[model samples]
Every structure is written in C-alpha cells, then in structure tokens.
Target chain A: MKHCLILGAHSDVALAIAHQLAKEGHSLWLAARRFQDLEPIQKDLEIRYGVPVACFAFDAEKPESHQAFVEALPECPDEVYLVFGYLGPHPGSLEHPTDARRIVQVNFAGAVSVLQALALAMQKRGKGAIAGISSVAGERGRKSNFLYGSAKAGLSAYLDGLRNYGYHHGFHVCTVKPGFIRTAMTAGMDLPKPLTASPEQVAKATISGLRKKKGRVYVLPIWRWIMCLIRNIPDSMFRKKQL
Target chain B: MSPFKQSISNWGNYPLTESLVYQGKERPASGPYIARGMGRCYGDSASQAQIWSSRANRCMLDFDSNTGVLTAEAGLTLDEILQTFVPRAWFLPVTPGTKFVSLGGAFASDIHGKNHHGNGCFSDHVLWIDLENAEGEVLRCSREKNQELFELTAGGMGLTGIILRVALQLHPIETAYIKQRSIRCRNLQETLEQILAHQHWTHSVAWIDCLAPGKAMGRSILLLGEHAKANELPEKYQNQALKPHSTQQKNFPFFLPGFALNSFSVKTFNFLYYHKHLPKQKEQLVHYEPFFYPLDAIGHWNRIYGKRGFTQYQFVLPPDQVDGLIKIIETIRAHGMGSFLTVLKLFGPQKENYLRFPKEGFTLAMDFPLSPKLEGFLSQLDALVLKHGGRVYLTKDLRMPPEMLMASYPQAEQFRQKIKEMDSKATFQSLQSQRLDLHL
Candidate 1:
C-alpha cells in the first residue's frame, strides 16, 4: 500500500481526502497546526479501514518548520496532498495588511516551501506524486474576494510550473481546481447550490487525477466550462460588473 | 459566533418555526437551548428558540473490534457507523427505521426497532454518555456511575442536557443479510396471532392495510427476520458474507402537490402493497438495507406527502388492551383516513424508567397528511389511547395536549422534578418540553 502525507489535515476537505485514501488501504500521515485535534481522526481511520495512520505537528504559517517536518517523517511518502488554504474574512481583508499577508502566505508561499522540501526528497527517491488543491475562484479575480482569489491563482500557476519540473524529474504532480465547496470554510456563505460541490467530490476528483497522472482536474466538470467562460470575459466588461 | 435567525423544521415538515440557530461544537453560554441532530425526529422535540446543532461535532472517538464496542461523538449518524463497521462484521444493537438519525437523537428517543421484542431500546445498549449540563459541566453518566442522571437522560428528549459522546455495545453478525419470512394475515386478530407465534424471531413487524373495511379491516402482512448466517447465504454471497450494501439511492426530487396523497392514492398504494405477497408464506434472504430501512432507499421520501407534510401517529397500547387497539384501527377506517405506511410491532417487557416509550404491548405507527381536520381527528384518537393506558411516541407527536403527556407517562412529574434539580435555571428546553410543560 502507498503511504500518503496530508498537510492541513484538520480542514474538512483534508479529512475527506484522508478517508478516501484510508478506504483505498493507503497508510496516512496527517499533519496540522493542532495535531492533538487529529488524534480521534487517526484512531478512527486506523480502526475503520485497518490502515496505519500517524499524526505530526505542522504549521503552514511557519515555513521554517516545513523542512524539519518532512525530515522527521520515518519514511518519505509515496504521495503528498497539499489540501490547506486560508480564506480570511473578505471585503475588508485587503485593508488589513496582516490579513492579506496571511492569506497569501498560507495559501501560496507556505505551500511552495513544503512542496519544495517534499519534491527534493521524492526526487532523491526517484518516485512520488503530489496533488495540490487550487480553486476555481483563481480563474478570475472577483471584487468580492480578490485577496483570497489572487493567492489561489498564484498557487495554481506554481503547481503548473512544478508539474513541468516533475515531468523531467520522473515524478508526477496533479493540480485540483474545485468550485465552491460546502465545507466548514464556506459554511454560512450563501453560495448557489448547483455551483457548489461537496468536499467528498473534491477528494474523489483529486485522487482520480493523481491515479491517472493528469496534470489538472476540475472537481465538477461544469466548473471547467464555467471558468473558461469567465476567463474569456474582457477586462473592461469584467471590471464593470460585480461577480 | 453569533446565533442567526433562521426558519427550521423537522423530518415531518410541520410546525415550521423561526428560531436562532447556532452551528458549532461549543455549548451556548446561556440557557433555553436544545441540541438538534439531523432533525429527523418528526416533531418539535428538536426545535427551540435557540437550537444548537451537533452535526459538525461528528467524530469517532474509539472502537474495540475484539469487544465490539464503539465510542463516538453524539453527532455521528448510524449510516456512518454502518459504513465503517458492517464490513467488519459488526452492527448496531438497535437501529430505528432510518439510519439517517444521529446517535444522540436515537438515545434521546430511546428508539426501538422490529427487534425490540428481543433486544430493547437503543439506550439499553449504550454503556455511557458524556452530557453537557446547563452550567456547561460535562458529566460522564452510566448505570454504575451517576446512576440517577443516567436513567433520567435516557429518553429525556434533549431536556436533560446536550449529549456529547456515547459509548455503545454493537452486536456481531455473520453476514449483512437477513433471513426473512413473510406471513399474510387476513385481519387484525390474525396479524396479532402471527406476531405472537413468531415471538422467537429476532425481528418482527406487520404492515396493516388501514383502508380495508369491516371483515377485511386491518388485513396485514407480517415480516419476521433473523441475521442470516454465512452458511444460510446462496453461493453468490458466500464469498463476501459480510459485504456491506453499496446500492445507489434514488432521490425523490421534489415535493408532490398536497392533493397528490389524497385518500384514493393511499388506498391504491396500500392495496398493491398487501397483495404483492401472493403466497400466504414466503421465505427469502434479504439485504439488511431493505429489511431494516426500506424507506431510506428513497431519499427525501417524506416529500411524497406533499408541501403540507404529514405526522406519524405512533402509540403503544398495553398487551391486554387489544380491544382498544381494534377500536382505534376501526376508527381510522371509519374516517377513511388512508395512512400509507401502517407499521405494527409487538414490544417485549421494558423496565419502567424516566420516559422510554417501549413496553410489553402492541405499538402501531401510521403517517397521515396534515390538514385542518387532522388536529381534531388526532385529538379524538389521543383520548382513546389515554383511556386505554397508552401514550403517543413523543418523537412523532406534534400537537398532543399537555394533559395527555401527564396522563400517559406516570413518571413525567418526577422527570420534571429531576430536570428542575439538574438545570435550576431551566436553561435546556425544546418546543416539545415547553408544550408538554416539562420545564419548570
């Protein structure tokens, strides 16, 4: 069975992905800022699926600890899932420099640091696959949530570059861009039901893309066409309308 | 987080209320709140001015395969537990008609099943529970420890406190299939006789044709079941005896118009149902899903009752009160009220306690669409039930008068006294508790 390491294991989507992987008989390494909170999840997954699961302390805000967290693992994981992203309160988030920086650091900069450490280690081992959760919000910046959207946009572009790098390094990378997901992150938000996908749907799409070695995946097929339409809208028109 | 005002309803879709909804794991800092889970109770038991949902608190805390015990957050649904443990040859000791219910809801209702004749209510299998009282103190209650609190909370209808976590015993099964025997009974007498004759079966229930008239009144089909052993399975299922059900569910997309479930339609549905089993007796191997939760296969099946919704009139009459049970069934027939799903089951003797519903008697549950006349009609039925020393299931009741609750449950006053002692401020309360005068 393949061993998978999941960063931001405390998030709803991350937990869903962990369940999917464990169901498939894969050993899991769950890491999060408050690893103690993951003890129940670890015990549950292990007992339910009869798969070995371990938890580790991780903080996406602290890139300095990313390398040591990777080095401390008893063994390099065959696959790594970067399922963490922070969408701070919108509308006024950009006015607070600290909030804007947190959005960018947690969703993009911290991800790059951890991916770099994992990629280098996997390169030495000569086989590994990585799946990173991006967002359809990144396809086009909306006035409503541009701060969080732009950070995801940067993360998506970085995943593209990493996929190219992995092409030559004999490893693989999959970028998953999901539409509005009904998770704790977006709990009270009044997103349209038809446009929203559940966390389980996102997890399934990500796992399937990784298995097929596809470079990119859209959690909901409709999101791909929806994003394509939005990306084609002229800047003049897009700037005039609130999306 | 601030509580938001929202309109909410239970599975019955009746008595919609505008309430302050708080969604999180932490108990609200103040009083006058009720804990809701999946909102499947069909009445006002889970509704309150301040409703705290335990949906997000779901998590499995621990499990021991060797002992077949599981400890999990109260918010976890039976469906989730089945998905995880059925494959491992373990099953819930007692599950209600639908697996969509939360563990906490099950315990609060002390729900019983067809197997109630042999086993008991869900609380009978629960080992311990951690309850958050009005003062936010978490008390670990079990029969051996905090004994009084444990007994009082078993069927307290979320008034005792918020259930946090529960440790329960699970029964081991040889397979995920049930050996079923279907027996046709011509009338109410025959149905009751068949049920008594099949007392040895682990599970027994009957579907009565409420629309049948006179000599044909209460004509029913009795279904008895036992967990199928591996050797009892056919060759195809022998290899994976404990294979969990993996069937795709069909969703009932939208609410049918209120007029759609009129008497004619119900009569037709009941006619076909009773005649579907042509033979007097038939034996077969059925999957646990179809046997225990036939309605769950059709998601949102409640919508079939229409936008006006419906209420399930469920009550258990004492074993010696067969005449009263007959009079009640005849009255429904006389009124031409076609109850589409009329379920009847025999319950074994239960140790009288706080508010558990099950007892040594005949329990019947029937769904009737709500209308202006429904209130008056159900009130008449309530009088009959109370006269016969029976009580309506609070989980399914919506408009029973407060006097009925006091008249039926002898311990109601004692339960209120205990609640007054435990929650002096009357912090934990629900619409049902308020309507029944459970809160001091």
Candidate 2:
C-alpha cells in the first residue's frame, strides 16, 4: 500500500484522484483551504474505499507554511499530487495586479514552493512520484487566458526540470496536461463535448501515467497532437488570430 | 463552480433547453436547487431550470453487515454499487433496467425492476432518506420521521427536495448468477397469462415486439429468474460462489441517421427478435446482468435512435381494464409507427404513500421518436391511459397533457399541497413541476 499527500485537495480533480488512489488502498493526507469542508471527502474515502485519510487546512498562497505542512504531516507519503489551479472571472481579471498575481501564484509560484520542500525530502528518501496538473492551455499563449496559461506553462517547465532530477534521484516526476475538464471551474464554459472530460476520467489517466512512469502525458492524448499543431503555426499567423 | 448558462437534455435528446447549470462534486453553497443524477431520466424530471448535478456528490456512507444495509450518497450509480457489493454476496433489492442510474435517481423515481411483483419499488428497500429542502436545511425522512416529506420525495420527480443520501437494504444472495427461463408468447393475452403464471418467480418481465400486427400483436418473450446458489451451478463452477464477470461494453458511437430506425426496419428487427426464441419455453443459467438489463450491454444504446432522440411513454392499467390495454396496442398499430423497445411487466398492489407509478395490474412501456406528429399521438395515448384509470410514469413521460396528468394520478393534488408547504417560498422547482403545474 502507498501513502499519498494531496495538495489543494478540495478541488474536484484532487478529490477524484484521491478517490482513485483510495480505491487502491492508499493512506492519504488531504490538505485544502478549509478542514471542515474536507471532512466529508475524508470520511467518504475512508468509508467507501476503506482507506486511512486525514485532512488539514492549507493555503497555497502562504508560502512560509509549505515546509511546515509537509514536515508536520502524521505520515510521510510515497507520492505527492499537486492539483491546485485558479482561473478567476473571465472578463478583465488581469486588470487587477493583485488578482492577476494571485492567479499566477496559486497556480504556479505557490505550487512550486510547496513541491520544492517535499521534493528535497523525497530526494533523500530516494523513492516517490511527484505529479502536477498542468493544462493543455499552457502549450501556447491565447488571448482569453494568457495569465493562467503562462502560470501553467511555468509549472510544466518546472515539472520538466523535476523529471530530469527525479530520474537521477530514483523518484518519478510526472507532468499532466489535461484538456477541457468538466469540473466545477469549467461548468458553464460551453466547451466542445469531444474535448471535455470528467474529473474521474482525468484522474484515472493521471494516476495511470504516474504508475507507468510516463513523465509527461495528456489526459485524452489527442491534446498532444492538437498542441503540436498549434505550436507549429507561424508566429505571424498565430498573432493575427484570437483563440 | 458558479452557475453558468448551458444547454442540457435528458436521456431523450429532444426538447433540449438552455438553463442555469451548476455541475460540481459538492452541493453549491446557496439557493433552491434541483438535484440531477446522471441525467438518465427519459424526460425532463432530472433537468430544467437551475440544475445542480449529483455527479460529484457520490460517497458511500455506511454498510451494516448484519442488517444487509448499504448507505450511499445520492449520486452513487447502481453499477458502482453492484460492482462493489455483488462480490460480497449481496445485491440491490430492486434495480431499474439500466445500471447507470444513480441511487437518488432510483429513489426519487421509485424505480421498479422485473421483481416488482415479488418485491416492490426501490423505496421499499430504503431505510431512510436525507433530503435537503429549499431552505437548504437537511431533514431526515423515513417511515418514522418526517414521513410526509419522505412520501412526497419518493417518486415526487425531484420536486420536493434534493435527496442527499439514501440508506438501502440489500438482499443477500448465494452467488452472482441468475437462473433464467424464457417463454415465448404469441400475443398480448398469452403474454399476460405467462407473466401471471410466473408470479411466484423472484423476477419476471416480458419483451414485446410492438411492430407485430393483427393476431400477432404484442408477441413477446417472457423471462423469469431466481438467484442461482453455488450448489445450483454446474459442478465445475460450484466452488466459486462470487466471481467477478466481465462488464465489457461496446459503445454505439455516433447517432445513426434519422432514417435508420423507421417502421420497415423496426418491423424487420422486431420480427427477427420474436422468432429468434422459437421454443415455447427454454431454461438457461446466465449472469444476472444480461438477464436484467440487456440494453446495458450496448453503451449509449439510446444514441441508436438518432439525433432527434426518442420519448418513452410508460403507463400501468388496472388488470380488469384489459379492453383499455388492447385499445392502446391497437392505437399504436393504427399509427403504423413502431416502438422498437416495448416492455411489459406486472406490478403488485400500490404501497401506501409512495406516489408509485405501478398498481396491482400490468404496465406497458414503449419508446417513440419525437416528431411533429408525435405530440398528437402521445396525447391520444395519454387520453387512453387516463380513461383506463392508469397514470403515466412521470420519470419516463416527456409529453403527457396537463389535464391527463391530473386525471391519472389523483394523489398528485395532495402531493402538490405537501410540496407547497415544504417549499413554502416555492424555491425548489423543476421542468416536470412546471409542466404539470404541481405548485397548485
């Protein structure tokens, strides 16, 4: 049996992955913004799938608390999953510098801080898998959500660097790029049906990739070709279009 | 997620509408809400207006081994429960034809299975329900506490309140297999006789070839089953009391073009199906899954009906109203339109305060494609059903006249009164409630 530490665990993706992991009989530590809200999910996993689960209050924005959160956990985890991302209101979100910074910080900078603290300990322990949920949107900058995309892009690059470091340290670092998941965050987004996946689907794919030691994988994998095609477009043509 | 404008349809793809949808793993913070579970209702019972999907709310609460009770979140699918419990030598006391339905969907619809004659609706096995009313207050309802609310929510079409969790009693079984037998019936009369003769069986249902005409009308294959004990199985397999069977499914892919399932094609299909079971009676031991829900084998079988989608009209007539039942068959034959999948089942006496669709007689369910002509045809069927003192299954009905709804379910008026009292502010609302004018 494995032990997993789920960061930003309140989100549906994180909880779904937790459920999947719990089904495999893994002990879990669920950290989110509120311990009260996480209680139900913790109890659910424990009862339904029969796994040991503990939840704690976690704030991704509080960088100082990252190291302590990891060290203070009751048990060390064999795997750490990062599933925290924030894409605020659609229109004029970037106009506020603090709001824009928060989005970037929560989605990327803060995640890096927390993972770094955990990674150092895992490096010494010499066996663990670190999985972070980056997005297909991070493949290229778009007019609609470039701020969020840029943060994910940075996270993806960080995971890339971590993967190389992991290979040498005998641990696994996996970067997951999901495309258009039908989560609470994307509920009303009028996304294309063929492209959108449920959280369970994404979690299953994410877990399977980590299990297989696939350093980087797309949820549907079709997004890989889609992103490849987009990356190849001429700079001039891409600049003229608004996507 | 905050609510957004999205268009969602029921299992029947017709009459799609734009609504405020909040699809999340947790209940939204505030407001009156309609809980949607898998959106599997053939009609708008699970959709319409501000919809809060139960997809994310699935959690198993508790299981009592001694009592054989399993308590789970409303969003837990029957398939998931069966997967978990069947290997433990337990099975759902009652299950609808599909495994995709959520526990709450089953509870709210009070869905029945082939064994309704032996058992009852899904609620018969339910120990209690946790309902969240319009004010967002959770109330525990059962036969003892908040009994009125319990009666109203079960088969209330999700109008009363959101079913948060349900504690259900499961039937202990010796093995995960069904001892099934099939009997061929020539027409409606013979079908009824066969079904009645098999009342002692644990499970009984019939598949009618609706396209058959004249003397061959209502030709069907009546099937009955009992749980196969380990000793009852063949010598080679007797030791394995609970072994997992394959749940491999084949998707239907894209919708077949509109012309794919017309009368002629359906007739050919029905004729072949009717003749396929040549023997008058045949016995076989098969897995419980195929015996109960054959359509589930083909994932997205509803897609076969094409983009326009189809509507299922299911109603039960009193056993004495044989003429009314035959008239309904004749009405379908007169139109020369084929309902490819028609099912006939016997229902026992109505359980008190359930708002149950079934009565102490026979229920006939048939699907029809939505078209301009369909509305008028359904009205005729509704009128016929109303005249027979039978009510259409609200969970299955997409288009039954408002007046006919009143005529069919007389208990509905009292139900509406209780709904108004519970949701005094009239916050909880759904497409079915509005269509039926349930508020009054």
Candidate 3:
C-alpha cells in the first residue's frame, strides 16, 4: 500500500479519491483549509477500509506557508494529489481585484509553491508521483468563466513543465483535465446531463491514470475531443456567440 | 447559497409538487420547513414547499466496534452504512425493504422489516438522537432523557423537528450471506401458516400473487432467512465470508409505456414467479442484498410502472382480522387492478409511540399503478381497512383522507398538540402533514 497525500481533502472530488485509495488499502494524509471538516471523513475511511489516515490544517491561498506544510508531514508521501481550486463569481471576480487574486492564488500559484517543495523532497528520495487536477475550461477562454479558466490554463502549462522535470528525475507527474463535474462546486448550475461526470467517476479515472503513469488524463475520454473542438473554434467567430 | 425552485417527488414519483430546494451545509433559518433525505419515502412525507435536504449532512460522528454502537448524521443512508460496516462484521439491527432510505427518514417512518417479528422497528435500536427543534435549538433525547419528546419524535414524521444526528445499535453478523428457505404456499391460509411456523427464523416475508383467483387466491412464496455461519457457506464463499456484496445495478433508464403493466402481464409474471420454485420447499445460501432488498437490484425500478407513477398501499390489521385480509385481497382481484408487487409479513407487539405503523398483526403492502379509477378503488379499500380496525402506513400513502388518519391513529391528535407545544408556530410542515391536517 502506498502513502498518498491529498491536498484539498474537503472537496467532494477529494473525498471520493480518498475513499477509492483507502479501499485499495492505501494510507492517507489528508490536508485542507478547514481540517475540522476532515475529522468525520478520516474516521470513516479508517474504520471502513482498515487504513491509517491523518488530517492537517492547510491553506491553499497562503503560498508562503506551503513549503513549511510539506516539511511538517509525518513522512514524505509516495504520491501527492493537488485537488484544491476556486471558481469565483464571473462578473464579480472580473470587477474585483481581491476575488480575481484569490482565484489565481489558490488554483495556480499555491499549487506551484507546494509542488516545488514536494518535488525537491521527492527528488532527494529518488522516486515519487504527482497528479494535479486541471480543468477543461483551460483549453479555450470563454466569456462565461475566463478568469477561472485562465488560472487553470496556467496550472496545466505548469504541470506540463513539471512532467518534463519528473522525466529527467525518477518520478512521474500527471495532469488531469475534467469537464463538468457534479460536485458541491457545481451544485445548482444547469450543466449538460450527459457530459457531467460524478465525483466518483472522476476519482476512478484519476486512479487509473496514476496507475498507468500517463502524462495527461481526461476524466471523461470524450472531454478530450470536446476540448479539442472548442480549441479549434476561430476567435473571430467565437467572440460573437454566447458560450 | 440561495434556494432553487424545482419540482420534487418521492420514490413513488406521484403527486409532484413545486418546492424551494436547499442543500446548504448549515441549517437554514426559516419557518415551516421539512427535512428531506434521498426522497425514498414513496410518497409526500418528504416533499414540501420549502425542502431542507439533509443530503449534505452525511457523516459518521462516532463508532464503537466493541459495542457495535454507531453515531452518525441523520442524512446517512443505510446503503452507505452497510458498505462501511458489513465488511467489518457489523450490520443494521433492522432495515426496511430498500437500503436507500436515510437514517432520519427511517426514524421518522419507524420502518420495520422482515425481522419485525423479532427485532421490532428502527427506533427500538436507536439509543439517542440529537434533534434540532423548531426554535433552532438542538436537544439530546433518549428513553432516559427527554422521554416525552423521544416518544413524540419516534414516528412523529418531520413535524416534531429536524433530526440532526442519531446514535444507533448495530447487530453483529458472522457472514454477509443468509441461509434462505423458500416455501411455496397454495393460498393465503397456507402462506400465513408457514409464516407462523417459521417464527424462529430471523427474517421472514412472503411474496403474494395478488391477481390469483378463488381457490388459488393469495398463492405465495414464503421466504425464511437466518444469517449464515461461515461454516454454512460453500468452499467458494467461505474465504470471503464477511465480504460485503458488490452489486452491479442495472438502471431501468426510462419510463415504460403506460400500458406495460396491465392485469394480464402482471398475472403471467406472478404465475412464472410462483412456479419458478418448482418444488414445495427449497433452500440455498444467498447474499443479504437480495434477501433484504430485491427490487434495489434494478435501479429506478419504479419507472417500470410508467410516467404516471404508482402508490404502495400498506396496512396492518389486528391478529383476529384474517377474514378482513381475505376480503381485501378478493376485492383487489375483483377490481382487476393487478398489484404487481404484494408483500405480507407478521409483526410483533408494537411499542407506544406517537405515530408508528407496526403492531401485533399481519401487514400487507401492494403497489398499484396510478389511474383515474385508482383513487376511487383505494378509497373503497380504505373504508374496508378502517372497518376491520386497520391503519394504512403513512409513509407509503400519497392520498389518504384526513379523517382516515385520525380514525386509524388514535394518538394522532395528541401528536399534533405536542407539535404545537414544541414549535408554537408550526414551523415544520410536509405535504403529508398538511393533507392529514397535522399542522396546528
């Protein structure tokens, strides 16, 4: 069994991943902004799967403390999952600098800070794997949610670079781009029924990608072609239509 | 988060209503709200104009393997509990027909199961509950503490208050499989006799052929079960004796055509089902999933009844009312309303609770497809049941008249008064409560 560390343990997707990993007999280290929220989850996984689970306080918005948090882990994890993200209100984030900064800091910059420390530690140990959750919205910017999309686009680019770095070393990194997910994050939104994937489905795809050591993974295979079609749309024509 | 407007229906998918659905993490501060969980109650017991869903509140607060006592949020479904605990050799003391019902919903309905002849209802195993009163105050209740309130909320429906958390006693099991014995009965009399003969069995129920005529009327297959010992299982299953059943459920996908379940089709299905046993007696080792919840194997099985939906009419008559039971079955056959699913069970003496349905009698539940004539036919059955001193199960009811509820449940008025004393403003309400005029 591997020691897997999950960074945003409070999200629905993260919890699903934790359950999947625990069911496979993996020990877990769960960290989230509100660590208290992880108490019940920790107990549940431990009892249900007969695995060891530890929870710690983590603030994804605070990049300065990322390194310290990584160093303080009970032990270095065999695998790390970057699952934290923020989707700010559309027009509100566009108008307010605070909101826009939070969207970027949590989804992009904070991930880089933590991964840098984790990569250094894994490099010294000579082997590790990292999987980061990106978004399909990053493939092409849309007026509906471009701010969140841009931050994810940055994360996807960063992971591509990180994958190259991992190739030089003995470790591996996988970037996961999920389309619309049915989670607390997208609860009431009128998402297309057939395209929306449940958190459990995303968790299964993530685990499968990790096992295969693939560089890039899409939760729903169809999302890859959907993103491809969206990316090919000409900006001249796309700018006039509502997404 | 703002509450969104949507049309909500229970498992029955009938009598749909527009409601403001809320799924916030914290309890919303509002008046006249009802807590809904999984919406598996089969009727309007969980639907309301303002629905406060406990789906987001699911979590296990505490568990003691030594004592098999579990403390969990009210929204946790029995299915989740079984998945988490059964592998560890722990099981629910009592479970309803479907594992999809939430802990709070089970408590509100005081659901009984095949083991009711011995273990009693769900509330009997509950140690204590943390209830959020209408005043938005959380109170700890148990038989020893806040005794009166405990009795009031046992089957009080959501009218008492919102159930926040519950501490329940879980039973121990040696394996996840059950040693089952299926007995084919010729008619209603033989079915009841076989059920009585198998009183020592932990779980017992009969599948009755509701459309069977005269001499063959109420022909059924009585199933008696006991948790299988590891040694009782075959060599193939012995190694993984405690492994929980992994079911790959198939969805019905969409509603079938309205005429899909006509009397002729139902009769043929029942005939095949009854004859499938071949011999008078058969025994085998089976998984708990099929033993406890056969219909759950087919997801959205309700859609098989078609878009108009169906209602499960369940009622229990006094032990001496055998003639009444026979007449009721005969009446359904006469109407040619062919109930596709008919279940019969014997219940032990019931405890004194506000609105619990179980009693010391035979309870039969039948599902009928909705039609214009259904209401009128059911009303006839209702009058017949009331005449025989039987009460319809409120959880499965979508259209029982208010007077029938009062006549059936003698303590209903006292339960309503207790709600007034607790909420004062009648802050919690449900479509069932309103239809029965339970609100002050």
Predicted complexes: DockQ each: 0.50, 0.51, 0.49
Candidate 3 lDDT tens digits, B1-440 = 45666688999998788877777454556766799988988888998888888887788878898999999989899998998899889999999988998999998888899999999999999999988887678899999999888788888787888888999999999999999999999999999989898999999999999999989999999999999987788999978888875657889999999888899999999999998889999999999998998888899999988999999999999889999999999999999976777999999888657788998899999998888999999999999999999999989999999999999998988898888887788888998998999977
For residues B1-440, what per-residue lDDT tens digits would candidate 2 score against the true structure?
Answer: 56677788988986687877765444545544577888888987866667888777787878887888888889999898887788888898998888899999998889999889889889889999999877668899999999888888888778777888999999999988899999999999999988988899999999998778889888899989999987898876676667654579999899988888888988888888888898899999888888877888888888888899988999999889989989998898889776788899999887646356877789999888777798888888888888888888988877776777767777877887887777676666667767778776
Error of 1 at A101 (Å): 1.6
Q: Please list all clashing residue pairs in model 3, or write none if there are none.
A: B32-B427
Compared with the real two-chain complex, what DockQ does model 2 have? 0.51
Model 3 residue B27 CA deviation in Å? 3.2
Q: Estimate the overall C-alpha local distance difference test score of candidate 2.
A: 0.84
The lDDT for every candidate, in the order shown, is 0.89, 0.84, 0.89
Model 1 C-alpha RMSD vs. true structure (Å) is 1.7
lDDT leader: 1
Off by over 4 Å in 1: A91-93, B1-7, B18-20
Interface RMSD of 2: 1.8
lDDT of 2 at B199: 95
Clashes of each: 1, 1, 1
Which number leads on DockQ? 2
TM-score pick, better of 2 and 3: 3
